[model samples]
Target: MNFLTKSYLAYSHGEKTVSPWVILKPLGWLGSVIVGTRRAFYDHGVYASEEPPLPVISVGNLTTGGTNKTPFVEFIAEQLSRWGLKPGIVSRGYGGTTSEPVVVLNGRGDRSVVGDEPLLLSSRLTDVPVAVSSDRMADVAALLDHDVDIAVADDAFQHRRMVRDVDIVLVDATCPFGNGTSLPNGILRELPGSLSRAHAVVISKSDQTSPEALRRLKERISHWVPQERIFYSRLADPLWERWDGERFVPVGKNMTAFSLTVFSAIGNPHSFRNTVLKSGAAILHEFEFKDHHHYDANDLQKIEDAARKSGGKAICCTEKDIFNLPRGYVPRVPLYVPRISALVEEPGRFWNVVVQALRPQIVVASNGYGEDAIGARLARKAAQRFPQAEVCAFPLVGSGIPYKKIGVRILPPLSKSPTGGIIKYHLRDLYQEIKAGLFRQISRQLSAWNQLRSSCRTVLCVGDAYLLCHTLWGQGKKALMVATAKTKFISGHWKLESFLYRKGCRKVWTRDEETAVELRQNGVAAVFEGNPIMDLSCD
Candidate 1:
């Protein structure tokens, strides 16, 4: 290892001895403040989160890098796919020239436009599509358009803006918590305290650690996440693709004793090196590039020189690095890649978490014209977005004539309001209507759903959100209340009668940014999704 690399690694693992790397400590403190402040902004509803159209699972880490994110990401995606879900990946595309989010894989496109990590995923996942861009929301939205059932974000532990159904955090078992500091000073991206928000914690590369090490890690992780939410995983036995004489062959065993030069451009090269050694390869030479480094002709030439210098028989690389290599540019010596599989320790339990998140089908309760329209639109689109799911809809007003026209399954309405909840315009009618036991009828219907709650998943309240009575009052499997029409059209915001109703909502998506912004200004976690009415048109 280089001097700086060694020093940084030592510092990251809690070494306090003063060194040149210590100069950056103050900067780390500054970064902590900024990161904390931004998170506080999200927590306080200053900046609201937008939920992806499909159910999303986020895979990330507390440390800045070297958590073996891709392998675990692959693990989660594959497991989800095995359960008959069409899962897609959304990545930041760390190293690439592209600005807009684009589909990297579907048997079309190359590395230059798609970025390396996305291309890596494309090659690994035969059943799923991979989209890459810095704009996560755009990429996710596009993925939903491709009929993706579930969305997985590669590294989004701190991405509060994109609300996820489940946050699957990967803690490197080798170094579960890094020096317990934030950035520059250490490897931590967020303080350990923040892990409390994670839905599950995964201990990656557990194969390299001792049982005692894993026990200690679990003890610490249990403080943040429940023991049931913790999972263990490791990279499985590797299939080495090597050039055997004239033709390239995949090396399964026995060839590991042969001397080879290893190279990689991933977050955790040390972990990669250790895995290579464990595979029984006699290390001849090693080249470590910065994470996500784009390889070139000169780099390949240098690797060849290293192989010749060490008298190595072959050059080995990671499966992730294969995409960046020039197409059809076969080298003189064998260019082999270790095709590793991400194997979860307990597959049944890990898959159960994903299946549970996918179970919550929407129950739209539209109380008015605009709301009924939006609800029907979303109901149809929901079916399209989650075709594997059995979606249920409940129009809370006007006989659900529009829903009937569109072949949507409508739940029993709560109560019929003659004034249609426009009490200001028809107060006398509203009074007479309420006096005739409208509240009682509504109570009876909410009770019916509450009883059969096992049959359905969420309570989707559309229209004037405040008008939603007992439907969102207490019956909470999962609930979403959306504002279909802009509040600007109806003057100021509604008084929010059941102010406590906001607490019951799993999520609240608004039709426009202005309305959502105002809602957040008043401390409501309302997400702005561009006109769901238009979004459903594609469905």
Candidate 2:
């Protein structure tokens, strides 16, 4: 079962359940194993490929959902069609029963076979084609056989085997990277660094993001990919498109202050909520589902009931969710679908770069991997330079476990001062003892630091020191707590210093210029190297 389903079930039972760590521990290990095996298989040429007839444009993201990929794909397909080129869309047909290539919209055949989005396109245009297949490569090949000029892969970022002419990565303006970790550990599909391979970075949901936040995000992305083309786009919500059985009817008016029964099966329901609110619609009720959730008859009944009880004027949903709903569901109520479009502030410069990459002169090769994982990629580079050295990984232990077990439980001192001492004095004494105890515990774990110091030339840390310390202990490294003033410290000052001392790390790196000055004033010899964390690129 998925994380939400398991969590909900546990809560419903009212039983003491395992923590997130307990659950993710096995999953994390499994993910690591899968990644490793996949890499090995690729290296051994287990899954080789053949080239397709035309250029393929993949619209995808590292995270599961929230990126406005569907609308962006539509935009690209429309642009291609306008240029007198036939573009065929190939999707994984997520949540659909069909596994084989199904021509949703042939541009020449009956439109009923096509889904809502495809049908919507078919009704509006007569030159574009849309199809779905679980095997994306096969679908693209089939489209090429039909004499299509170009093929667009919808949400195929993780499918690395199908070589593409251009890769467009979309980042949601909010929560771009979830806790900055892979699935089971966090929300990311691949490591954040994998974005470096993207040809262009499109910031979606820009309307909800502040100018300052957008600037900071850009600055962060600039560190890893200096030459990447970044573009800003927002979802236009004031424009409405309602499906009238066979075609979408555009309603030109600001839908502000209208009562809506908002329901969606998209990854980020909160994003939909904010979008509707921006359009001046009051959300009377919100029905959220798992990503790409296929709505059944019972689900429709629930929505109908909620809409009636709330006295909503209409039932609103995302374009994706509309395809999954029953054919006659919307006719029963005042259902109005909000059509989403990626409004690019600058299109000329963005398309120029995309066209440059699409030029026939640029030869592309399949890497046989979707995108390299950060740890694995780093290990490979490190191995290349030091052929004989062993590569070790120090990953942060999943936070889910600790958070669930502790449940806000603070660590306590092992002993108390004698009864004769003043209460304040006793408290101070207890604090010092506890600090010492923490140091001692850390020191014992790192006793083999000397061995690692002699054998290994360099120690690679997966992330920050708190999690790094555990990995260091696993690899027998003399981990010096690289304390920064910016690091969130929960305990008292004395405790923090003591903990650092026990970890065998006295060298600290300050993130900001002011932090270095503050640390020096406080008698800390912190070097202002700037924040390493900010250097991360989301592509």
Candidate 3:
């Protein structure tokens, strides 16, 4: 299911109040094992290709969509061609019917078979070769047979099956990693550190960002992939072209002017809409589709109806969407196409890293605690250590020992608290809102956790009172969940501590003077620790 649907279900059902870690723990391990096995195969050359024909540049992002990868790929292709090199574009042809490499000669051809992106590219750049295939490796091989010099692989950053000479990772200027968690949990495809494999980083849609924001983004990226070069790129609107089936017409403000508005099924629809709005045209109506949504007769009919109702002069759309238009659909409406090109600055540094990687073989080497998780003293220590990291100390974990167990919350913005002060507790009346608040908190925490994992090498998680630490441990992060004697002193919620122990947290730092002795008697590794606040003050 999509993220929104899953979120709605979790919120409506009050599932967030119950610990998801309990259910996700086993499945997470299974996923880890599967991932590990897959990595081993790729590392062992089990999936390696023999005598790969030409250099492949894979452009992709960790999240599902939002990053403008297509335009980035187009930018690279255009650059290569300008440098007097032949470039062939290959895509997975998402939502397309064909599995074989289908060459799209023009936009008039079967969009369903070749997909919108390839068809669009084919129409815009007739000289460039564009092909679509589910199996990229086969497509690349086929391109090689046709004497293609280099292959530009779209959205192939996670496709480790084929070796790429240069990996360009793109991040959306805004919402780089939504809710920062992996799929079903958040939006990440793999873990965050995955960007370390990228030869260069491109912050797409740089126009929307300020200089300071861009710098901060660069710093964050540098923290994870310190060695990789970074560049800023923005989308530029070329001359608006309208296709009337027989010929292409280029028009400016002088021509018979009409307000142009657009909606698209592309990953980042907002960008498409904003581009149209930026153009000196009136936006009468807009309709968005799910990413890679295949258009049907009904969809087209609805769009036509909307256009007719708007009574606006022209219907503008993204080239990607235009490629998906049903046969004879464009003729029905005065279709205006605004061409998008990537305006890249500081290409020298970005391309230099790519060239350097090509010269030699690139070798890539690649949270939680709970209360005992929270106490005034523990909070003081955390504040000292992680002044920037948001601290969330709550009673939701149900750990019997309040002082010893504390939960650290990350990514605070996603959660929303009620506006008014606490009302006399009414469980039934506040049920839905409480449940929604909890889900939002968990969602934000998950996003923050994923973002932290992606950006940091080591994260310290205190308090084993909650199962959140268990969730972190499951994801293969180095996490230390501490539980003190004060934490065990509490009763009903303290039962949750057992869940943390079950999830493989080796060290439980106890606040009790005799914690080591007591844990040894119970066959748990418990070390006695002096007050954490003292350490914080000294540092």
Predicted model with the maximum TM-score: 1
Better of 1 and 3 by TM-score: 1
**Which scores better on lDDT, 1 or 2?**
1
How close is every model to the real structure, measured as TM-score? 0.69, 0.60, 0.60
lDDT of 1 by residue, 381-438 (tens): 7788877666666665557776878788776644566766555556787787688677
Please give, for residues 341-371, the per-residue lDDT of candidate 3 as tens digits. Answer: 7877777778787666554221000011223
Count clashes in each candidate, considering only residues at least 3 apart in sequence or on different chains: 0, 5, 31
lDDT accuracy of residue 276 in candidate 2: 81
Q: Model 1 residue 277 lDDT?
A: 84
Q: What is the lDDT of residue 239 in candidate 2?
A: 69
lDDT of 2 at 407: 29
**Model 3 CA lDDT for position 272:** 77
Which candidate ranks first by lDDT, i.e. highest?
1
C-alpha lDDT of all candidate models, in order: 0.72, 0.58, 0.60
Q: Which residue pairs in candidate 2 collide?
A: 21-400, 21-401, 257-280, 480-505, 481-505
